[model samples]
Target: MAEMRLIKKGAEAELYLTDWMGLKAVLKRRIKKGYRNPDLDSYVRGSRTSNEAKLLSEARRLGVPTPVVYSVDKRNCEIVMSYIDAPPLKRFVDGMDPEGLALTFSRVGEMVGRLHRGGIVHGDLTTSNIIPYSGLLYLIDFGLGEHSSDIESRGVDIHLMRRALESSHHEVSSEAYLSFIEGYRGVMGDLSDPVLRRVDAIRRRGRYVDVNHRKEA
Candidate 1:
């Protein structure tokens, strides 16, 4: 095992880029929390690492282009996966032209739709979690993922992406957002009415209007 350089640090896990078994790989290690009791903390970490691996396997089985899992150490509360050598979608779209932006959004939507259709919901669907390489879009980070056949879960996934775009990429927010939906709907034909309603609610809430004024007396 070579020195693991920190690639990403998050609330639940820290990602490191290192050589595993003589191949380049990503190592996601659960961080220890001092606030919680030792026993409970260990259990939570173990469970999370296991769940992430299971979800990734499920997504990959359904043909989602995620990193392939190489190994897992439940005791260490860590997982090793293939490293994707591509810029995150956030960086990729930062300099994209109109056509490139549209293509990127469409592809993101399609991938999400496929995952939802296969009964998976990526709890976090931000551009930062996606990579654009070789004209292919790959979704990463299953830490918050769950299996859900519910349309609302799927809608929330898309809604999160829209919100992320609004806050992060303000310039092309309108057009890029529309392209994302086009691809999502193209796959999840006639999405449940409830899902659309929830998406509308997400939009309304995103306006950041006074919550008290919005509620009917």
Candidate 2:
């Protein structure tokens, strides 16, 4: 095992920064849960780890900006992958001018459109999962991602971001998302309007709506 520096520990996994084969890498090791049945625990960890790797590869194949997957080790329930040196978008998006913000969010929307065009839904599309690397934004953390072409699934994914932005980046969230929609439309063509309509319908069915809209209503 390479010398690892602990980066973060979440409920399901522990992230470590390490050097792999002379290249910098991130090792996401799924933590075993003691409360669950031993066999079930192993199965869950193995499947999620494998699925995450698959999702990353699929996204890359679909031309989405995602990390390079190095290898998967089911025995250790770990994934060793390229280290993205850039900061997450939550930290990166701060204090930018409105024009720069709109451009960046538009690019973000295009990335989402690319993913959806391939019938994939990034189960978690939070700012934390988006990183900027060498002037391009890359999506990371596919642990919650899934392959789905359903409009509801796609709508919900977009809706989740609307919720996240409303809760976290309230200051510029509204305008940022509008920029995203514009980019989405540019990339998705005819599909954009329907998906966005579903986004609105999905929001209406939920307990919350966009914060700005709620205020105006």
Candidate 3:
């Protein structure tokens, strides 16, 4: 086993930086759960690890720039993939020129549309999942990804991206998000319209909750 240093530990998996075949790689290992039966836990973790590997591979085959999956060990619930050496889009957004940000945002939108067209839903579309390297965008972390042809699922994908922008970079995020929409509309067109509508509905729901809380306070 190659020595791997832990990078980040989440509820489900621990991300490690490791060396593989002379290239830098990421090792995602599902943490063992004692709360569930061992057999059930193993089944769930193995299934998720396998599913993500297939989804990522398909994304690459379809021309989406996701990390190249190196290997999957179902027994261990581990997946190894190429480690992106670039900062995530969220980090770069702070230092991006207006023009660069606009271009990046457009590229992100186009990438998302392409994924949708290919019948894949990223499930999680946060800026952190987008890595900007060598002036290109690479989508990462397909932990929640799935194959779906439903327009609502695709709309939810866009809505999640919008929510991520609002939460991470409010003012500039809005313009950048609009640029994403512009790019998405260029390709996905009316297919994304339902998702845009859902974005509005989600925002209203949030505002309603906020207003009620304020009134009570």
Candidate 4:
């Protein structure tokens, strides 16, 4: 076993930077939740750990850039995977010129299109979960992702992305989103139409809810 140094400690898991068979790796161990029954907690952690590993591998098979999964330990509720040595896209895209921002987000859109075309929906699609490495945008943290090809699922993915950009990259959100739509259409072509329409529907639904809340207030 290699010496592991703790890197990130999130609410659900802990990340350790370590080495595996001469390869730099990250070990993600799901923490046991005290609020749940011991048996339930164990089962949940094991299943999620296994599922995330499977999703990571599946995304790679779909030709999307992601960290190569090295190993999975269901017993320990942990996954050992290749570590991407790049800042998250959230920080990487900050202060980028318009042309560069458009290019970067278009690639991101293409990657998401590939995933959706392959029947995968990233439930938590955010720039923080993406890393730009080796001239490719690598998506990470599939713990919330699942296999789904429905229009609603794909629309939610794009909707979440748009909201993320609006909240985190507002300065360039409009242009970035347009570029994303362009690349998404380039990949999905006719299939992209329905999903894009659904995104607009979802946005309108959000606005409706917000309007109701404000009216009540």
User: In candidate 1, what are the lDDT values of residues 19-84, reduced to their tens digit?
Assistant: 988989999999999999999999989887887888888888887788888888989999999899
- Which sections of candidate 4 miss by over 4 Å? 35-40, 210-217
Check candidate 2 and list the clashing pairs.
Answer: none
Q: What is the TM-score of each predicted model, taking all chains together?
A: 0.86, 0.89, 0.85, 0.90
Which lDDT values do the candidates have, in the order given?
0.83, 0.88, 0.85, 0.90
- Order the numbered candidates by TM-score, best leading: 4, 2, 1, 3
| Alpha-carbon deviation at 49 in model 2, angstroms | 1.1
Tens-digit lDDT string for candidate 2 (1-217): 6899999897889989998899999999999999999999999898889889999999999888887889999888999999898778998566889999899899989999999999899888888889988888899888777899888888988988887788878999999899988988888899887788898888777577463565543
Candidate 4 pairs with clashing backbones? none
Clash list (residue pairs), candidate 3: none
- In model 4, the Cα lDDT at residue 178 comes to 98
Residue 156 CA displacement from its true place in model 1, Å: 1.6
Index of the highest-TM-score prediction: 4
lDDT of 3 by residue, 63-126 (tens): 7898889989988999999998877788878778889888889989999889988999998999
Candidate 3 deviant stretches above 4 angstroms: 33-44, 202-217
Q: Roughly what TM-score does model 1 have, to 2 decimal places?
A: 0.86
